[model samples]
Target: MENTSCCIYTFSPYIFLNAYGGLHGGAVAAVAEMVSIACARTVVSKDKDLFLGELSMSYLFAAPRNAEVIVDASVVRSGRNVTAVTVEFRLGESGGVVYTAKATFYNMPVASL
Candidate 1:
């Protein structure tokens, strides 16, 4: 199957900020995971379900509150049972990357649901 890609614009709220007043690492990771799963689902068959296997993220810069960040996610590898995806968080349109993440998902057959 062809690779799947998606983009979204998000705002870092103060509630998701860290002690340094930047976006919390956990929040960023959550976004990466959510996007990766969405990308995986697009490449997999309708009867298959994708679950998070492994995930890793590298925070290169801080995302300040109220700043509009762009999130781009794409599938890198789509295998029979395992799929890999990458996600990037940017400052804005055509801006530098603030965070990067790589994730692997395991596909399972969906039955009775």
Candidate 2:
């Protein structure tokens, strides 16, 4: 209920570091998916069934520990039966993009009886 077609969430998740002392990829993907769903819901109707059909995630740089992350998700397109959302994760301090993700959701109409 925050925005009509976009959602901006800021949080600092516990940095789960990888073996190379970088932020874990799974954590970024998980957060992106959660944000994407929220963004898609803003555009999708309540009566329709929305499902995440596709999600693409990319890691741009290594995020340091104790860094705040800003997640911005926006609905790129909303059609009669589908919606697309784009998500980006940026470091709050340096404002560098650490991860980016895109999601596609399928909106299914209610069955006619």
Candidate 3:
């Protein structure tokens, strides 16, 4: 997939504080998960699918609510049954990295939902 396809989300104060004065971890995780899936989709074709077996991230810096953020993901390794992906969350203007994640996707056969 084209790198330009990566999604960019603007950080807003509402998205940061929900009846609270701090950023929500779930929001961060959600962005990471979306990037992971997007990266996996770019690698596997229609005949195949990927299951997110494991995902991990380290939030190095607090994401500011005043700047634009971009999520970029790429495949690290692809195997017969597994694919490893890496995702980076960066500031759109400064190009500073705020978070990094790694995930492994599993390709398997199971009962179709």
TM-score for each candidate, following the candidate numbering: 0.86, 0.89, 0.76
lDDT string, candidate 3, 1-113, tens digits: 23323444555443654344444567777878877787677766657767889989888876655556677777787777887877887877888998888888897655578
In model 1, the runs with Cα more than 4 Å from the true position are: 1-4, 12-14, 111-113
RMSD of each: 2.4, 2.8, 3.8
Q: After aligning candidate 3 to the native by TM-score, how far in Å is the CA of 100 from where it should be?
A: 0.6
Candidate 1 residue pairs in backbone clash = none
lDDT tens digits by residue: candidate 2, 1-113:
23244777887656588988778899888889999998888778889998899999988897877778888998888898888888988899888898999899999999989
Better of 2 and 3 by lDDT: 2
| Candidate 3 similarity to native, TM-score | 0.76
Whole-structure CA lDDT of model 3: 0.71
Residue 53's lDDT in candidate 2: 95
Candidate 3 has its poorest 10 consecutive residues by lDDT at 1-10
lDDT of each: 0.84, 0.85, 0.71
Among the numbered candidates, top TM-score falls to 2
Q: Count steric clashes of candidate 2.
A: 0
Q: Which is the leading candidate under lDDT? A: 2
- Please, what are the lDDT tens digits per residue for candidate 1 over residues 6-60? 5464664447889998889999999899888887777889888788989999999
Question: What is the overall TM-score of model 1 with all chains considered together?
Answer: 0.86
